[model samples]
Target chain A: MSKAGPPKSHPLFVRITHWINALAMILMIGSGWRIYNASPLFDFTFPREITLGGWLGGALQWHFAAMWLLVINGLVYLIYGLVTGHLRASLLPLSPRTVWADTVAALRLKLDHTTGRYNAVQKLLYLGVLALGVLVVLSGLAVWKPVQLWWLAALMGGYEGARLVHFFCMSGIVAFVIVHLALVFLVPATFLPMITGRAPAPKTNEANE
Target chain B: MKRDKSLIAATLKDIAPDLKRIERRLFLRQSLSLGALTMLSGCDLGSGNAVQGALDAMSKWNDGVQAALFSQTRLAKTYAPSDITPNFPFNAFYTEAEAPVINGKTYKLQLSGKITDKKPWSIADLRTLPQESQITRLICVEGWSAIGHWGGVPLHVFLDRIGADKTAKYVGFKCADKYYSSIDMPTALHPQTILALDYADEPLPTPLGYPLRIRIPTKLGFKNPKFITEIFVTNDYPGGYWEDQGYNWFSGS
Candidate 1:
């Protein structure tokens, strides 16, 4: 609404990885639903049956194929994050002043108004999605190799329990995607930095150029 | 400074719409390509003959894949029989007394629903038909497994006798205790699959389906209905109690 601040931007690698993760996640969800639809849950079924290559067989192929994409992309992200210091900076919500101020700023819709790489809420959400990604993979492994990784099944309560958890985790990601897109539209500039790696520079003299 | 704000905002505003357009176009192209593939393959739901053909082709492909991946490893593991659990617990349906109630005196199983003929047959009727048996491991989706010798009638023999409709999507099993389970006809009629009247070579224990139970080798334990009542066919999916909760209805091994 007002000229609140100048722009900053995301790094090129960060943007690239972000977009790749988005694409992989979308494919995973689509095919995952197809697999889930083979035996529709509850009274609910997919609005339309997708026989990608044909029915359950096609859905399995799509799911396994997309699964590899998600696993590989996620590993790359995690490894890159660790090797570089981006992981530390992205994770740390330390300091009461920064955390409280950023929390208040985020709740007040002041995040978009302030000048920073990521607001507190953004950091929290990013962290959450990352954690969920890990859980999704782990729970998936329990389903994939139920006998081999019986311990994982035990941790999740059982094989059926693991499947339920995996299903719910995917559902959660779907829910998150809805809110994420809404947020993207609500703060369109927030999405721009993700793509172009650029934002309005802060009024600080260093950013004046 | 103000110029930069709107410039930045304007630039950023284009990103989402641009990305969304690109993603949608890509998805459309991929969907088109997939549609072409399906058209070439002729994949459709419920077209039983077509579905059977597709399954046959898939089985062939899977066989080749399996051969390449696992055929060389081992044909089958020979167990000492002692290696198997001695007192394999009977995972009962619903509860001990809660199975579907077939007439205790008459003890007839009615074959109805998506069938050419609807007839009620006694347990003696089933025994007169072709019989089969196999010793196999019962893998539960609950994470435990047990090996047991199962003896019963071949489902195809019964299906043939009852005259199953090609369009019958499911074989609905109504048990004595109101417990019900539906299985795809293909899985129901697998050669390895049986409707067991006995377990471990003796008449099945009351807790283990006594006079009748289903022994589905390729799927999880829950699909095996115990203390049989009526078997019907239907195109509509009739989910079992567990399947209704969240477990996969067709939980194949």
Candidate 2:
């Protein structure tokens, strides 16, 4: 990589959207846990007994409200990505030749080395996260309107099934976030673009040199 | 008690300053900090008759207001049986321990309420009343739901037989397995809701609600008391076990 703080990666709009989406997801998870604690699908709950103003209903209301925001914001972001050339450079996999080369390079380094902005692994993770988000939204609708969205409910096998999907989807997102944070600390340069809207743009002739 | 628009507006304006003062002093300024502290310490923000009474009264008023004003907006719509899930799981207070006698045949159905008509109901006695059946989904607050056909005697029919008085605003349902829950009588009497005695065109399975269970369509699955034994009519909303731990009492669809 060039130095530490040189400019290159994210647009200002993209950076703002990314942070907004991240904050919204965190709120969604926290509030969602409180909603879950009402009956507790598994055996987890938000720390309501310890927190001030820990209203479970309020949590659910916030969750549902944030859900709408996440959906709308995510959709807008996706549309922007598609309309712009960001999708190709940022989201999709790199060249086929680069995939295996990067795979070996990344494995040899044991995921410690950085190869370009987003490696194959990051691309794969982004794809999975985006797909899971869609699943969460659909499953959420199945519960929100069991009667109205009977077709979606039926597709998920029914309301309980839809709930199961929603729960698992949430679990996946949480898992992804945990690993993501770990990777962020693991590769500080990776997170620089997110915070500062830029990465160290590699020297064009440095590799040849 | 004069219900005139302008007069009500004038009265509200006259009391607005006093209401504002009390709100600013008690609720807005002092109580907010107190409320935050109480929440931090895991305590109810306000207490006693003045505060609790206000809360309880407001809860009741809200229920009434929702019932009256939102009559046009149905909370949810009923659906076809095709929408039912193939595998619906049974939850909480799953089975009946001792079979109770119903009617005069020594068959016993027990009543476990603090009300006057404290007697065990026989299966036959419960069956004697008019029965209604409907296929509805039991939506759980934990984000799950199950659609199944529920058959039960109208609680109002039983409540009438037991002579539930005007003072009885809430009904407590105690099951054979020690599971107990209370519901507002208005919800109890809702034409669509029922104290289900059967499931899927047969007597309730032991794993499900055996003798009887409450099938409240408008509420969450947890609110439906299974293996019901005792029924009590009280003035206060005693809340279900889960509800006591900070759950939505109404749990509307």
Candidate 3:
């Protein structure tokens, strides 16, 4: 890769919140699976170890405890991302026309983030994950307090409907994680920017810096 | 995994590695939640950790908020007769095979606490008090739901007839199945909260809270006590079987 200098991709706050959000989501999903096990929608059960707290009682504690973290960190990310114009400037211009092209390009292993901006597919997925995070929180509130947030619960097709929506959002998030990880693995260079807050050191930039 | 309430104060503190680090830092930013809950609800700092106290206290805060928001006039959604699930599942701490089959022939409901009348009433007396029915979904916290027909005397009517102190803080039920529960005074008096005597217009089946039960449609199924043997009104906090075990006490569906 050729570049003038090694540009910073993620800032410290973004990096910290990203990791925190990731950890929180993982804990929430794991414990959420344990909770789902109590009265499963399906027949088979997810293994217990995958869950955070190990059992139903423990799982609930983790679910709720992590929920606070997810909500707080996510809010910071959202407000800072929006206010700083980072999310909009970096991930937008998600033209429907270009999205398909970007998807094709991504499939061909040509999608790159050397410029510190997300491609259409990346933009869509990042935006989607963000939206799903909000949905998870909102739907979670409905489930957590149906009467207090009765309107939200009713809007979500009632209590049971909120659970369904919550599960689907979880699935969406898990899918995003899978794709996100796979993309990072394929373009290993895409990984460091998140962890180190600096883009992969291009050959010329390594010397220049 | 499946222990009793004695573990709540402990479990709430045995923080997962990630949660511990995060909770410590987040506490500074979220102390407002702590402040609001404490100031608004007067949460009792029972023998528990900061997080446990916070979780329990927050749940209490949630109860106050929900109670403030609850409307006695509002009704749970009703369903058509055909919509009543034919195989309305029986769920309890015990399996269906182990559901208690009370001797309805000799069983009498014991009433106590802040009521003028402490007299015990037979199941027959209960059946004759007032008959009403509604078909509604029994939402469970664990992610499944079932629609069933519950028929009973409105709890408020029964409480009124029994000369219950309407301003009491709580109405507790002692179940024959050893599963006791209580509701807030407002919830106890909710129009839809009934002392259920029948299901599907038939005498309440053994599998479905045999002798009598509290059918509170506005609440989760567990909040509706089953196989009730006694009813009492009081200012004391009467925690439910599951409530003592850490489930939110005022869990309104």
Model 1, docking class: incorrect
Q: What is the Å distance of residue B241 in model 2 from its true position?
A: 11
- Report every candidate's CA lDDT: 0.64, 0.64, 0.77
| Candidate numbers, best lDDT first, in rank order | 3, 2, 1
Clashes of each: 14, 13, 0
Q: After superposition, how far is residue A66 of candidate 3 from its true place, in Å?
A: 2.7
lDDT tens digits, residue span B91-163, model 2: 5421122333232345365554544586777888788889988888778765656778888887777777777
TM-scores for every predicted model: 0.49, 0.53, 0.81
Docking class of 3: incorrect
Q: What is the TM-score of each candidate's chain B when compared with the real chain B?
A: 0.65, 0.65, 0.81
Deviation (Å) of A11 in candidate 1: 2.5
Interface DockQ of each model: 0.03, 0.07, 0.13
Task: Locate the minimum summed-lDDT window of 10 residues in model 2 chain A.
Answer: A49-58
* lDDT of candidate 3 at residue B26, scale 0 to 100: 46
Q: lDDT for model 1, please.
A: 0.64
